[model samples]
Target: MKFDQKSSDKLFSKAKELIPGGIFGHYKYAVRNEGPKFFSKAKDAYFWDVDGNKFIDLICGWGPMILGYNNPVIDKAAQEQYSLGNTVSVASPVMIELAETLVDTVEIAEWALFGKNGGDSTQLAVMISRQETGKDKVLKIDGGYHGANGWMQREGSPGTIDSDSSEVISIPWNNIEEFDSAISTFENEIACFISSPFHHPTSEDNVLPKKGYWEHIQKVCNEKNIIIIVDDVRTGFRIDLAGSNKAFNFSPDLVCLGKAIANGYPISALVGKNYLKEAANKVYFSGTQFFNSAPMAAAIATINELKNIDATSLMNHHGNDLKNKMISMAKSFDVDLRVTGVPSMPYFRIENDDKELHFKWVDNCLAKGIYMTSYHNHFLSAVHRESEIDLIVSLASKAFEEIIEV
Candidate 1:
C-alpha cells in the first residue's frame, strides 16, 4: 500500500509555519513526493512510513546507518547510556575513550575533536587550518561538498563568495597542474586544500585519483606548508574505520569525519595532527549542543561495533557484489550502465542522451518498493543481504527492460 498523501499534506501544511518549507533545507523541497511520509520504524534493511508502506531504503539515511536502522546492539548501548543518566556536569569517560579509539585506529588522527554535524567539524577544520597556516584563502574542488556553512557553500559565483571572502578559490578536481598553479599563484595566502577523493557528479562516474596523484599533491602541500583537509563526510567510517585517507594511503593534516561515525546518529569529528589541533585551541570553536551526550554515547557504541566486525570490509564486499550484479543485468538489457565506486559505495548511470529516462527508471523502482533517489549516486548498507541483492537485481532487470522499450 502507498502512503496516504492527504494526511502527509496535512502534516506538511502544519509544519511549514514553524519549519521552512516544512523541513530543514532546499533538498527537502526538491523531493517531488507529494508530502513527507514520516518513518514509523525501521529494521535491519527495511523501514515503513507512518502509513505502513515499506521500502528497501537504498539511500540508507544518505550513507549513514551502515549497521542498519534500529540495530539491536546500538539500541542496547544507547539504552544503557541513558539508564546511567545520559549527561553530567563533568565529561563522560566514553568521550575520551572514543577519542582514543579514533586516534589508535586512524593512522593520521593524532588528535581529535567531536561535534554534532559534519558542517561543524569541517568548519572547525577550516578554522584550525587558517590558524595553523596564518592564511585566509582556502582552495577547494569546484563541485566538492564540504558542508552547508557560509564558507563551505560560498563559491566563485555571484551571491556566493564576495570580495571580503575573496580568499576562497574553487578549482576542478584531479587536475594536478591547476592545483599547483593555484598554490604557486596564491602561495602563502592559501591556507588549506579541502576535497573529496571520489567525484559524485550527476554523471555517476566513480573516478579515482590518477596514479601517484595524491602522493604528488601531498609533496606539494608539504613544500608550501599548506594544510590538507579531506572531507570524508560521506566516506568516513564507510570506507574504513579511519576513512578514505587510509584507502588512498595518503594522510591529511586535518580530516572531517561524519555520517557513519555514529551509525546514523548525529556525531562528527575533526581529527588532526598536533599543529592543527593547537590551532583549534587558539580559535573559538564551541557549540552548546556539541556537548550533547546522546550522539557521543552512540558513537562509542558504533566504534566498538566497527572494531568487532571489521565492518568496512563487509560493506565493501556487499557493495561490490551489488554493483557487479547490476552491471551484468544492465548489460543483458543492452543498456550501457557504468557502475562505479569503492566497495563501500557504488553508483550507476545509463550512457544515453535521454536523461529523463533516468528519472523514469527511478520512479519505476520506487513503485516496486525500492527507494532510490536517482541512479547517479546510490549506496549500499552493511545490513543489505544476499536475498535483497537478488531482489534489487531482479527488479532492476525488469525496470531496464521497460525503460529501453521506447
Candidate 2:
C-alpha cells in the first residue's frame, strides 16, 4: 500500500539548493522522508503527488481547502477577476463586495478589513485593539497559535527578541482562576485577550472551554474594558460561518479570519463592530498584495457558495462521520484513539502517552493514501464524501493493524 515518493524526494533535493530547507516554516516540519513532499494536482477532497500517488487530504492544505481543491466555482471567480486585472493602482470595488459579504454573514461584523494571511488579520486585530484602548499588553492562551507575529510566537524563537513577547501574558486554556489572576495582575495594562474559540494546541488533545467560561470572561472583560479578540484563523468557517464565537454564545469585539475564508484564495479578513471602526482606520496595516482584486472576488464568491452549500453544516457532518468511524475502528483494534475539537475540525490523538507509536500509526496512514498528521488537527471539507469516510476508516484500521503487528 506504500506509495512511491522518488519524484517528490528528487524535487525536494533540487529545491534544497535554491530554497532554504527545501521548504521553510511549519511546512518543512511536516516533511516525511517516505511521504509525498509536493503535489502535482488536487481536486475535490483529494490530491495527486508529483509521482502520481493519490491521497485523501485530511489536512486540506492545512485548512484553506474547505470547499476542496480545484473547486471550479472558486477557481472561476479568481480567474475571472484576474482576467479583469488582479492588482491595480487603486483598490478594487470587489474589496467592498467582499467586505459587505462578510458583514452580512458574520454575526458581529459591522465592518471588515482585508489582509493576505491569518497573521495579518491577527496582527491587525491586535493593533486595532491597542490603538483603541491605548493599552500596550496582550493576553493570550498558552499554546494558542495566531501566526508568526513575534508577540504571538513562542518566546525566543530564533530571530525574535525577548522584548517581542515582553508585554504578552500567557494563560492556560479554560482555566478561569488563572484568567482572573492575569486580569488582576495586569489591571489596566492589557489591551486585548486574544485566543481561538477553543484550545487546539499541537501534539496534545484539543480542549474546549468549560461551561460558563466564555460568559464569565466576557463579563469580566466588559467590566475591565479589555477588548475581546477571537483569533478564529484556524477554526473560522468550519465551526460556524457567523463566526466561531457565536457557537460558544459569547461576543467578541473583533474576529480574525483566514484559511478557509476564500476556499484557498489568498485572503484573510478582520471583522469588528462599528465602534472600533475609527480605531481600525487609525491603525495602518496594509501590503501591496492586500489590494489584489482576484482574492477579493474569490472571497465574495466563496462566501456566497458556502451559504449556498451550507458548508459549515456539511463539513461538520463529514468530519463527525469520519471521526466516529475511525474511533470505532480503533476500538476494534484495541487502540485508544481520541478525536477532539469541533466536529468539523477534529484533532486525532492516540492516547497511550507513547508518541512514537502515534507517529508510526500516522506514517502508516500516510503511506496508505490517507494524508493525516500526527501533531496538528485535521480539517474536513464540505466535499469529503461518505465513501471517503469509509475509505479513511479502512485505511486507518490498516494503520492500527500495522502498529499492532509491530
Candidate 3:
C-alpha cells in the first residue's frame, strides 16, 4: 500500500506561505519529493506521518535520535530537570556534572564547554583556536561540513563577507601530500586543522580514511604545533563512547560533539585539552539556552546508559548486518550497490547508468513503510533489534527488486 501524505501536503502549503523555503536547512521537506512533510509523533525506531502512515525511521532524526525517538530514560531525566527549573540566573550544577562526565568519558577531553547546537560549538572552537595560538589561518578539508556559521559555511555564498573565510584554507581529504602542501603554504599562520573523522560529504559515497591516514595527520599537526579539532557532531557517541577520535585511534586537541550526545535534546559540547581553558574564558561564547539544565541532565543520563549498555557496539553490529544483507540482496538482483563509511553510519551508493535510480529506490522503500534517504548516510539506533534489521533487509530486497524491474 502507498503511504498517504495528504495532511503533510496541506501543512506544506501553509508552511510555504508562512516560512521561507517551507522548511529550514538540511531537513527541508522538498529534498525528497515523495517523503512526508509532517510527522504526527515518533517513538522507538518509528514515526507516523500526519496522515497516520507508519514508518521505520532509518534517518534517526538526522543523527540525534541515537537511542530512539522519545527515549524514556532521556526524557525522564530532562523532565526531572525541567521540574527543578530549566534555566536560572546562574548556571545549574547539571552543567558542571555534564562537563565532568565528558571529561571523564571522551579521550583527550580535559575540559568541556557547552553550547546549544553544533554550529555554536564549532564557531567557538574556531575562536578559541585563534585566541590560543595567536594565528590567523585555519585549515579544513574540502567539502567537509563544519557548520552554517560564517567562517565554516561554504567558501562562497551570500550574507558572508570574504573576510569571514579569508584566513581559512581548504584541502582534499585523505591526501597527506596535499595536506602537507597546504600547511607549508600557510606555515606559521595556521592555528588549527578541523575535520570530521571520516569523509561523509552530502550526496556522495562516504569515504573512510586510508590506513595510517589519521596517524599521519596527527603526526604532522603535532610537528607543526597546529591544534587538531575533530568535528564529531554527527559521529560522536554513535562511533564510540570515547568519541570518533578514539575509534580512529587519533588524538585531537579539541572535539565538537552534538546530535546524539543528549539523545535528541538540543545540546552540544566543545571538549578540549586544559591548555585552551584560558583562551576559552577569553572568548565570548554564551547562549541563553546554553545553560539550560534539562539537556545537560539528559546528556548525563545518555552517557551513563551508553557506558552501561555498550550502545555503540550494538549499533555498529546492527548497521553492519543491515549493510551485508542489502549488499547480498542487490547482488541477487544483479544490481550494483556499494556501502561506505563506518557501519554505524552507512551510505549506500547505487551504480547505475540511470540517474534517477537512487531516488526511485528510496521512493520504493518509503512506500514500503521504511523511511530512508538517498542523499545522506543512514543511522542505526540502539533500539533497532535483530527482528527490525531482518524486516529492513526484507524491505530493501523488495526495493532492489523494484529498481531492477524498472
lDDT of 1 by residue, 278-344 (tens): 6778888877666656677888888889878878888888778888888888778777777777766
- The residue ranges of model 1 lying beyond 4 angstroms of the native Cα positions read 1-6, 26-30, 34-36, 154-165, 202-204
Residues 24-107, candidate 3, lDDT per residue (tens digit)? Answer: 888884346567888899999999999998889889999989888898999999999999998888889888899999999998
Best by lDDT: 2
Clashes of 3: 0
Q: Show the colliding residue pairs in model 1.
A: none
lDDT of 1: 0.77
Provide TM-scores for the models.
0.93, 0.98, 0.97
Q: Rate the local accuracy (lDDT) of all candidates.
A: 0.77, 0.92, 0.88
Cα error, residue 85 of model 1, in Å, equals: 2.7
User: What shift in Å separates residue 18 of candidate 1 from its native position after superposition?
Assistant: 4.5
Per-candidate clashes come to 0, 0, 0
Better of 1 and 2 by TM-score: 2
A best-first ranking of the candidates according to their TM-score comes to: 2, 3, 1
Q: Which ten residues in a row have the lowest lDDT in candidate 2?
A: 397-406
Question: What is the lDDT, from 0 to 100, of the residue 162 in candidate 2?
Answer: 96
